[model samples]
Target: MIMDLSKQVKIALDYIQSIDVSDIDDTSEAGRIFYEKFIPMAGEEETIYKIENLEVPSFEQTINIRIYRPSNEKELPVVIYFHGGWFNAGGLESHDRPLRKLANLSGAIIISVDYRLAPEYPFPTGLNDCYNALEWIILHAKMLGIDLKRLAIAGDSAGAALATVITRRAIQNNLNKILCQLLVYPVTDASLKTPSWQEFKDGPVLNYEGAVQAWNLYLPNIKEIENPDASPLYSDELSDMPSTLMIIAEYDPLRDEAILYAEKLQKSGVAVKQLLYKGMVHGFFQMGGIIDDGNRAIEETAQFLIQNFNK
Candidate 1:
């Protein structure tokens, strides 16, 4: 058995190592291949509310949204989620377990959005779909029994980047419906100059090269890659963003980016809290049962959401 760490942390690290490491380095076609194989290994859990996929009328695209509601009849706050796959992979199937746990832990309605992937739909497509889904949820809030004033946006990895962008777009558009953001190791910068990138150049799960590959697929163009909407770290206006809780891994490549974003948010007068889990790597929160840190991260996030939301 793996030792030299806490019981939970060991399990999490083992889970990370147990994943097939062969194709992980191949960023071209192998990235997709790894994800196709990785999702099934993620495991599952039963959710409290029924899930349904819906399409966006504006884009004429079929966007998958999994809605989780409590057993009570009252309208709860809505948490819109985007799953992580470096913007190229991950969907409803890969993230179902964590969303379910989040919904139950926070006692809120969870709406998980399967935004369009990269290299095909690219940049604005996925970001716009997420924002559009938020709009749809607000327009039909009454139907979904949702509290418009208490809505929040959340995501991991590339999804987290999308969440921050959506929050910025919402704020800029005068949509004051967002209450807070739960960002789990978000990729804020695309310049790849951050120290975290160099330190975790060979880190597990989300390696340094994988980061570049994902960005290449999403942006595909040199100019568009540096756009603030595509890379939140490039944005000049961090003000007007809602209260945020950013969870970072001590040993992950995106750690500095997440920290820098938190610093920017704080400088902008946005209430922000940063939680750093030591000796942890990327992709810990979503890998339930396999990692103790995953469970701990989920509980901490749920508590944070319950406290700041609707206040």
Candidate 2:
């Protein structure tokens, strides 16, 4: 039986439900309004480091990147993060608290990337921005006072897809510097017929219709669905990718894809660790103030990154 959510989770879900659903019709207007109004709702407490906006390579646009630096001043690991919004929504501002907590918990520097949204820039554009961010982080590790060899990439939902794709591209280009990847309820495949999609078609937070709309924005066309850059599940290589830590919400629509990706990674001889939190729905990670389970998952993720990368 599914467990009832605690009061905090209930409140968080209430806020989540209050956010307007993205309409595929007016991509920019709906997306902008939803993010401007909704992103700030996720708490962002003042922290030790300064948040700065910077431009990255391979793109003409100036990306918003936040850096949370520890006061200890010692060299720490760097985690480059992307926020979930199905490619059409979400940005650096939306995922502030989660990223801050991750930095605080892991005792690492967290760099959150604000890549371009889709239906405007489309595939490879957002993906490339994230890749450039990775490259920028690696190149400027010294200035950031982070250990370049300990660099990792992480994200939730669609951002998670970007994270995985960046890791694969890093491997293909022989950028051999990435140490790990953290994926939370990631959209691993663009083929919308998975059993999880059927079972959790109307599940809370992220539903089938919302997911399809998001995919349409990211993919922009049918032909791109099979491209590995847009869908990492179709990628021919996984053996050379970094070690992976994937978190899946049992009730999420994307659970099966998360599971299948883990299996494929393991089969391909890549080290993969998966955690399935039962009775949880998609976007639980962002509800830390409401869900005890959300806090627990974040803590587990922090520990996972610190423990593995500390090796």
lDDT of 2 by residue, 25-96 (tens): 676667666655554434556475555666665666567688887556667888889898888888777788
The residue-by-residue lDDT of candidate 1 on 1-311, one tens digit each, is: 12135565565556556756474575545556655544433456765756666665548756778787755657788889988888888888778777788888998888988888888878888888888888888888898888877888999988999999998898889876688999999988888888878776877566777777778888888898669998898888887888899999887888898999899899989999999988777887776656667778888989988997746
**Clash pairs (backbone) in predicted model 2:** 8-290, 9-290
TM-score of 1: 0.90
Error of 2 at 154 (Å): 0.6
Candidate 1 error regions (>4 Å): 1-30, 36-44
Residue 297 C-alpha lDDT in model 2: 81
Best by TM-score: 2
Residue 311 accuracy (lDDT) in model 1: 65
Q: How accurate is candidate 2 locally (lDDT)?
A: 0.81
